[model samples]
Target: MKRVVAVFRQQKFEDVKRALLAIGCEGMTISEVKGRGRQLGVKESYRGSNYCIDLIPKTRLELIVNEDDLEDVIDTIIESARTGEIGDGKIFVSDVEEVIRIRTGERGSKAV
Candidate 1:
């Protein structure tokens, strides 16, 4: 098993979600996050004052998939999230030792 963590600009969440669903992804966890990427951030003006925003809004998606599905899931996220621009975000995959479904007391792959 593997855990895929994908972070992208917030506005791209819907696009990524749709792609995931199209690929038959069962479930995922979503989060609103803020961070700086290679783009660093941008500047804004208000009342004749200017300020730099270092941390920008982002969306994080976390899901666990069987080993066989790892590449497909990563590809889906990238294709959906990439905007051909900076601050597009990143994806990380980690080894998962186990998974358990508390309600049914099922463990391992079945739990997932």
Candidate 2:
């Protein structure tokens, strides 16, 4: 099993979701998150004051799927999320040892 964590600009969430679904990902969890990357956030001016906003708002999408499906999922996310600009966010993949569905007690890939 694998856990895919994709983070991207808030505005690109819809595009990423659509791409994921087109690639056969039926389930996912999305969250609003704030983070900084190499460029280190952005600058904002409020009330005539300028300040460095080091923590930028982003959308985080997480999904768990069989190992065999990992590559397709990653490709979908990357293609959808790419904007050729900074703050496009990142995607991280990791191994998941096990998964269990709470309601049915399904384990392993069945739990997904």
Candidate 3:
């Protein structure tokens, strides 16, 4: 099993979600997050003043999938999230030792 964590521009959330669902990835956790990468947030103007928002708002999507589904899921996220611009965001994958469904007492891939 694997855990796929994707952080992307807030505006891209709907596209990503729809694409993932189309590809049969139905279970995921979504969060509203604030973070910055190499570009370090962005600059904006209000009235006559300019300011830097060091922490930019982003949407985070996390999913657990079987090993076989990893590549497809990653590809789907990338294709849907890419904007050819900075802050389009990033994806992180990690091994998942186990998954358990408390209500059904299911474990491993079955739990997923």
Candidate 4:
């Protein structure tokens, strides 16, 4: 099993979620997050003053998928989350040792 953590622009959350669902992804966890990447956010104006907004709002989507569907899931996220510009987001893939469904006690891929 593998865990995919995809962080994208807040505006792209809905599109990314829809793409994941379309790819037969059963479930995912989404969270509103604030952080900065390479650009370290941008400058903004509030009223008559200009300020540096260091932390930008983003959406984090986490999904555990079987190895067979890993590529498809990543591709779907990348395609849906892209804006053809910087700060579009990032996707991190890592090993998942275990997964257990709390209600049914299901484990491994079935739990996903």
- Number of the top candidate by lDDT? 3
What TM-score fits each model?
A: 0.96, 0.93, 0.97, 0.96
What's the lDDT of the predicted structure labeled candidate 2?
Answer: 0.91
Per-residue lDDT, model 2, residue 50, is 96
Question: 6-105 in candidate 4: lDDT tens per residue?
Answer: 9999999989988888989969998999998996979989998999999999999999999999999999999999999989999999999999999999
lDDT over C-alpha atoms for residue 39 of model 3: 64
Candidate 3 wrong stretches, greater than 4 Å: none
Candidate 4 deviant stretches above 4 angstroms = none
Indicate the TM-score of model 1: 0.96
Candidate 1 Cα misplacement greater than 4 A, ranges: none
**What local distance difference test score does each model get?**
0.93, 0.91, 0.95, 0.93
For this target, which candidate reaches the highest TM-score against the unseen true structure?
3
What local lDDT score does residue 32 receive in model 1, on the 0 to 100 scale? 96
